[model samples]
Target: MSEGVTLDRTGGLITLGAADTLWADLMADSAVPTASAALTSFPAHARMGYVLLGDRVVATVKTGSSQWSVLEIEVRQAAAELNAVEMDRQDLVRIGPFRSAAKQEPMEGTALRWRQRITRALQERGGLERAAREDARPYHLAGIDWRRILVEQTRDRTVRTWWLPRAAVRVLDAAEHTETQWLHAARACQASAVVTEPSSHHQQVPALGSRPTTSPDCPTAPLRPYNGELQGHLYSVLSRKPGTSRRVAGWACAVCRTTPATVLDHCHEHGYVRAPVCQSCNTQERPDHLYSNDIRVADHYRRLFDTHAADWLRHWHRCPGCRARTTLPLPHLAAWTAHIACRSLRPTHRDARSSRARKPCGVLRVSWTGSHSAPRSCLLTVAVDFCPSGEHRVLAQVPYREAAEQFRSWLAETAPAVAAAAGPDRLDDLPTRPRPVIADTSSDGLALF
Candidate 1:
């Protein structure tokens, strides 16, 4: 046995000649010493690369911590002819092509933005130069021709105002033609057009001698039969083979993951649908919709509270109400408050009595007093009051009231049994201590306590 080597259960330096010979050899050598000795001397900071040729094995092991180790391993592996080409041709083709293709394709967001910016910049510069070079000789012409020239200039300006961007014009013309064709097809499929009769039709009957005939003056009755088969055609087109352009284009609803729906929902606020959405999301997002209003209001209040609470806690030295140092910044406070509050308020569907019994076991309120205090100390007060028994009340001065309230509510709602067992009165009776102050050289005293 080597002096530094320590044998393990596998016996001293027993190596295998299987598919992973290099890995086996390394394992054997490493295991020969105790973990601590191996770590201190040879170390476990080694990597091995191995290739298998049917039953034949070839491998190279290198210590990641030493350059000499890698060089030796590379030389040994090269001598053993381990770097033979044995990967499947299909796998090589697929992976090789994919890697090369990825390099050639443009990155989605940034590439598109860059192209658009370049195009806009070119258009602006070219348009300005062209406009500046346009002749204004008409304005300098004889008085007799001035009026005509002025009219022509005015007409040109009007035409320019009505001009559409080339891209937009192309799209609009295409859409117009499509709409016209669709309307024509629909009409052709209908048996007859429904027309409304005039109120005076009874009195305006043609002269008695006039032959009974269909004429432009005579109104047709309502409820005409459709003569077109457009609907059937549309259904057929939509039902085509799965990867067809029509089917793909028809798959517009991102939420429900359906196709050929009533209406497409575009979440204007979110800009794009990361996935499919249906008309439900659209209806809920309508401007006049109550759901939309509620969502917007909730988001606004959440953001407002988050921002102000953060600023208040960061700048304030003491808790707003109880004047305690346990008050943390908005984020920490919010998390704690949410945890507590959710535990206290547990809404259930069993009955009104049970639900009310669960209704917020605690309440927290934060009011800012407009005072120009040094380093500003916002008074944070926490009050934990329960309803059912109406026997519990606890108040503490916390730095971030909003966070404290949130945590309190969360805890109340999520863990009712634990919360109720703790009893609200216990909070007030608990020992109170001053929080450590954070040292500040700029101030006469510590800013936080």
Candidate 2:
């Protein structure tokens, strides 16, 4: 071994103690360099400066700011110059005639001594070196276990030892020319890692023959149809088998045509899928009662098959219900009626009951509008608003007969005085003046014409 710290010769590698913070700052800088313009040289006065020796990088930073500069240099040449002189252990580094002392304990190992020596050499070259002697307390180089030291191989075929950092640490080397390039590469890699897309294991759309018990748009809870036949029809229409022909590739709702068909609406009575419909049409058709009978479902299917016979034959070999091309029976219709009649018996068919149970009690508002200002416009709008809780919302609208009935029933049960103030005779024609009735009523009443 040489008089100084032995350098590993197998690969051009070296070891030195570094402050965890300085090494962290370098790696961080490697990840993200400030947007500030580069400076030509170290400023006249620096708040704090540190010397490290792995790749030979010297960092000078402003006291309270993130602004910093890292410098790399020839380790062999600097270490040689540092060994030329002999001094007491108190000496940290020598800058020409000026010398700085370790305030606590003198550095023992050759690596640390070389670092101190090189730091002073650079300061001397710049003519802004540390004063005659360091009066500050010596920083006990943090103990880094050799076993845990991270060895990183650079592209230049040179391996370097990175001191393990508990937190922000010191640096151990200098190589100024490559500092900017290294930082840029590190940052690019970090950015790429950050923006990489994450993979999810959950499937949104199911394969053919497999039914999804949940809708993608609303994922709060899963949807489980009451009957197996209903579930099968839902799966066939709502999902597609891989590689199947897509007649309605960009198909929109048949009823609204304005919105995408996300919900698979079916006849509640026959459990037969009618067609894809928007949420609005689904709500509207639920009250139609036109498809409430088995005969009606069969008639509707016959009409659909007759109109799109070519499309039906292209996808399926025969009618799904009867499994025969000649005559189609209403097997789904029977399943639908059976499911509806015994729905309350199933444990999973509790969504409707649960929803109704959660309905809150609040206020009511009614509004009526005549024709608008547009030419040849004949629009009469009637809407009813109800808020059982503080959240005011529109309960119903149009013809206003159903809304009026609901309002009257709620009024009679909760706040009868408000209903009496505005008599039933004027229900069609809301009173011009606002009625003052129950002051502490749970619901607020508003009537506008």
Candidate 3:
């Protein structure tokens, strides 16, 4: 087995210490000179070195019949200049007539002395003449030039000692970058390994006949029905499968889908379960219906009062016996019915009497035509009034049988006038036949004429 020598190929120059004196001397005398000579001969490679204080090199010269030797060359070089002199340690060796002691320590070591001597000889030979021609590029550890160190280490069988450049080493050592590279490599290797695996016999089994395997990670649940309007609540309904029970959870309006329903309406009158109703319908529709129904009843009473007033006015040529006006109230059947019903439901008789007294009576005023004016016509203005006394009174009296006969004839003749007076827009609404009344109570029993 060959013993391997360790080489520091970590880039840049490695400084040597006192223990390395012999090694430094040998390297200085042999390697440094050889390298300098090569660079000088090429004139393309740049070469340089710093001189130390303690090491020396022995050079032999042959004289006639004997060997001659000289000692204490005391040569030192730095900043690429060389000269010989006696010097103490840390001497500024290049550039001056100044003695070493004046600005620097005295120069030491034979090797450093030899280095100075050789450096002078080389400089005198015009070594720096090629400095401008030689490439002055700087070496960066991150760049390609450092790879040469690795190659050298590999060739010397010292690969383990080799390392990438400083910057590259830092990147490789980072936890995040290392983890990313590891994951990428692992995924790639796993995929490749899977590709290399042999196919199994199980793949030949029929897929249709295989027992159904439910994925353990995703369990199936039951479905639910949607009962509310499709708005904000649609998503919650769709998330469930159909035709299955889900938690009722809370109440919501079935129609509008607005929550916290305004009213729970029971269809007790129609015989069904209670259902949620929205505020808009609850607050508006119920009251409106009652109002409309009252209007219908009020209209009937108003028509009766108007008929009596018209007949009494025509018969007596004045207002009625009750001292009521001849004009009739514009019939608001709904309000009249509501007023009456409200009165009927009063808790006490006095309360009912007060309500009735407050009830509105129908009346009208007539502006009749003079004999020279348009034929048999008058302008009728109806107004509603309330009586202080809660008493019902008949304004005109005639035989009931006779009043009925006259009203029928009068209604027939006045139907067209009434229809026309209602509005030209409503002329199309004229009834084809007369609406019949069961009785007329305007004559003897005070029927409304």
Candidate 4:
């Protein structure tokens, strides 16, 4: 009981162990006394980290409020014990035996811009003096070993802080070589999730008793043959012994977890297959230096709305005030009128670069294509007196004039001002048929006039 242990929480019970010593942390928050004083007096926090075996670290997160369900008890070796070499140049004072692996000359137009960015970076780190002195050093054929360096790389505002050991990584090069130490060290940090056990857990957890850097043997299935442009290079780097198609496909797309992986997405700057991605995610374009796969995330939302428009429309109810089918719930006349007016007030645009869609008449109104008869049309059509954006439902055709009268009376009673302005004239002015135009037809059964 004196030694600390790693812990995993399932529902109300906490499973505390690493090397097999079980303990528990329960949830009772009334200041009651218990046998284990430590558990009773545990501080209220979302996450807890503990040290075990002097150099190993374990962590858990609270997943529930009432029961304090701590989850994903993971153990990691302390970075210090690896005799990790610090590679940051901020502390260095001399040019001794350190240089970039490859020559990178800025193009004609970018020379000044590149120099300015470099200067700003150097100034921030207080390394301008060291850099100036290093420029005087004679060119040498020797290159620094990237394996021993500890560097911080930044992409998409998320700073990746890690140590790169050469033997544990592999990256391909322009010359079709998979032994480039610099490229491997640069991109190996993004490897796809390799460990899957304990069905509920979705993260990559290292196998118990295995070194943190060592990945388990690839699956037994035969490797898939490559037929792409980089056949030789891809096979050499990706088809290595510990790599397998089953293993890659077993992992979800790194950008969007909902899709199974089909493409090995890598950093083009350095040939490292960071993770497996879906076709949509791998092909999407993004701005330079922003590598967080925001394009894939955007596409996810786009497809969600585009594919499930009908499903979403089901949740909306007709507004009594404007009879528009909006995201707002029904019977709330004031709110519905306000929502329509606000949407219609927004400026419209045709520019592809605009973030917001141009809604010429912010209202979302639907039309009745069931009948051309006045009474029947008024009862069934929602987009007739308003913009076409409001049509979001399928209605059964009705010949009853009472239904039309009831809707008109409800609209006038709910919003007197709007009804007074768009009164009988609007209803009487309803178009019998939509104009013969390209925008008249949509798969959703809603058309814009």
Superposing every Cα of model 3 onto the true structure, what RMSD results? 49.6
Better of 3 and 4 by TM-score: 4
Top lDDT prediction, candidate number: 4
Local accuracy of candidate 3 as per-residue lDDT tens digits, 182-255: 23444554465544577542212112212111111121221122243222222233335452122221233333
TM-score of each candidate? 0.17, 0.15, 0.13, 0.17
Per-candidate clashes, comma-separated: 55, 36, 29, 11
lDDT by residue for model 1 over 167-259, one digit each (tens)? Answer: 221222222222223333335534454557544312122232222112213322221222221211222333344654322223433332322
Alpha-carbon local distance difference test for all models: 0.26, 0.27, 0.24, 0.28
Give model 3's TM-score versus the native structure: 0.13
Per-residue CA lDDT of candidate 4, range 1-449, in tens? 22444343342224333222221122122111111222212121113222121112222323344332222223122222222322223221111111231233433321112122332344444453444465443111011122123234433664322222211111100011111211232245336444555544322333444432111222222223322322113323675646465455545445445344555644232222345544434433111111111011122222222343222222111111121211111111112222232233433445455756543432323222332222233332222123344433222232224443444465455544434544323334333432221121111110000
Give the per-residue Cα lDDT of candidate 2 at 392. Answer: 34
Better model by TM-score: candidate 2 vs candidate 4:
4
lDDT value, candidate 1, whole model? 0.26
Worst 10 residues of 1 by lDDT: 89-98
Q: Give Cα distance to truth, residue 129, candidate 2, Å.
A: 81
Q: Give the range of the ten consecutive residues with the poorest summed lDDT in model 4.
A: 170-179
Off by over 4 Å in 3: 1-249, 288-449
Q: For each candidate in turn, give its C-alpha RMSD to the true structure in angstroms.
A: 38.9, 32.9, 49.6, 28.1
